[model samples]
Target chain A: MPNILVVEDSPTMRQLISFAMKRIPNSHVIEATDGVDALKKMSSEKVDLILADINMPVMDGLKLVSLVRGNPTYKEIPIIIITTEGAEEDRKRALSIGANSYLPKPIQTQELIRLVNSYLTKQ
Target chain B: MEKETGYLNKADEFLQMFKKGEEFTKELLKENEKLRYKIAQLEESMERSGDEARTKLYEDRIKLLEDEINSLMERFKQVEEENKDFASKYIEVEEENNNLANLYVASYQLHSTLDFSEVLRIVLEIVINLIGAEKFAILLMDDKTNELVPVASEGMAVSAAPRVKFGQGTIGIVAKEGASYFSDNLSYMKEFNPTTPIVCIPLKIKEHVIGVISIYSLLTQKSGFTNMDYELFNLLAGHAATAIFSSRLYTQSERKLTTIQSFLDILKEKPRR
Candidate 1:
């Protein structure tokens, strides 16, 4: 019963991600419009993993990753950065800042599930 | 006196014969004891050999059973590996099914609204999320001017929107010919060029070309088009065209109805007498 937090600004993309996450066995998905919204939701819900987009309004995903890593309370939770930014530098930056994984957009749903499952099982 | 001496000699001979007979009986008794000991030793050796044979039989049977168990274990491992492969294939099929469902939902959302802006927004979303297009524009043919005009755009500067006449360029040719054009080589360059769209899909209502959807660039992550992307383009060719066309007609009719109502209101005013 892992709780997956999906942080995306676009409604369509958010719906697509949440739809895929719901297929996991007994997994629960929480939606957030942006990184700010994601941080607010994290305080209330016990999130097991985070799937965030890098380019977002207000607080971006990279900033969120840093903040989450800095906090002792939520630092252990796995964060997967799913974004359209496919550059090697972007990936390296996200990983250096404490993101667990970086997945480019146009995501294969099976791959997404497999990566999440691997992380969740580790937990 | 002679007769008494003969009798004494006979007595001596008989006593010597009896001593010889006693020695012979003692030798026979010793031989019998040795034979009995040899028989006992042979019986013990035979018993030990029988026990060894039985132990060897049991050990061979145990070895055979162990071999059987090892062979079964190997087969079990093979079956487990095959089950894993099957599970992986099932996930792939499920992912394909989900992609189809996404296409269905996108098509459904396109026709669900009659608002012109809403239709445009839905198209924008479909391209961005489904096709992974970073910059694109939707152009509609203006009936009066006979030229394609940009109705909506995403990730493009407002000054970059262009209007093209029939058979003017690639976008114009796509509009005139009603055939989709997709670039063979997708550029990784981030520069936005309005003139050279990587993909230009003409929106058509049956054989009639209504407008065109031009894609300037795709998201960096999308390396090339997929089967799903091609299916979506076909869907937009027909379904998106119909939806946009219906919405535009509805908007125009609404405006005409308001104008007619205004005329009626003026006539009913009776010249303000």
Candidate 2:
């Protein structure tokens, strides 16, 4: 069983992402409000992958990426940055910081499903 | 931080401010390539494996990957609300700048002239242009009737002639008390049955209120007045009162001088006789 964590602050967006994720047969998804919440969830169990937003209160996704990459225990876990914005600088910093992938906001359903499916199949 | 998206409607060009985090596109693309490389290694391992145990391990990893995809699909739902909050906070700062600018202009133009007509014109300008009053009337205190009467007006309904008594309506209430009365929503107040909202600001000098500035409605949003609107009203209260008073005094003095000179002319007529 693979555990994936979803980090975002908006209730509406979280539901949207969850609705799209149902296309994936039978994987368990963890919902986190921010980086701190995601890290807390990670400490208790195995999170195979992470899907996070860039801008969040308490802890943003960028800082989370740096911390997760630094941690020996969770370093290899694929981290995906899901953001409402995807500027060039944002992409470079996120990738350089060790995020495995990124996705822009208002994500299309099929595209989201396809991308996640591709990453999963490859791993 | 200010919490409202109302200001975003005013500046559509700046909507991109929220999208400043766009760098994820290029970075994610590069990351995908790296993932593909890793995938090739995984495929190679699976292809090279001959032992049943090694084959089982590859299958296990592939199965795990399939499950992980489901969870990764659901990401960042409530985060946009936070972005909206940030945008609203920025807009609040912008609104403050606008308030200060309007205050400065209204104060400066109020005392810019001593002529009565010019003084009246500036009052109308401040009311209409700076304060964004939709329909307004400037009423000065009449010495004989001890009444407040309209000197100049714009956008007032012809049928809704303002004949407010000393203690009647919002206009009269402000005049009697010499205090400003503002309401964004008039219908909600107890016993406040006005046809439309009208902010009544008493124009004052020291303790004396010389007149009332009646704002019939706001041009932008008539629902209510912001703190900045009240600040403008405060400026008008003191500055406008003094300006109108001075202009009236100047006109009165000029008339007095003319009467004095004509009397002197009558007295000097003996020389011609």
In model 1 chain B, where is the ten-residue run with the lowest total lDDT? Answer: B184-193
lDDT of 1 at B15: 79
- Candidate 1 residue pairs in clash (backbone atoms < 3 Å): none
Residue B153, model 2, lDDT: 75
In the range B1-273, model 2's lDDT, one tens digit per residue, is 133455655455465643444566667878999999999999888777756778799899999987786555543334566678878986676566545545665666677778887888787766654455656788777767777777887666433546566666777778889988776564443332233235788988998878888776554333455576678789889998998999889988988999999999998997899
What lDDT does candidate 2 reach at residue B234? 91
Worst 10 residues of 2 chain B by lDDT: B188-197
Off by over 4 Å in 2: A1-123, B1-98, B157-160, B184-197, B220-223
Best by TM-score: 1
Off by over 4 Å in 1: A39-44, A57-79, A88-101, A118-123, B1-81, B108-112, B143-146, B158-161, B165-169, B172-179, B187-193, B205-208, B253-273
lDDT tens digits by residue: candidate 2, A8-72: 77543454465556547877788899999999999998887788888889999999999999999
lDDT at residue B246 of model 1 (Cα atoms):
98
Which lDDT value does model 1 have at A46? 98
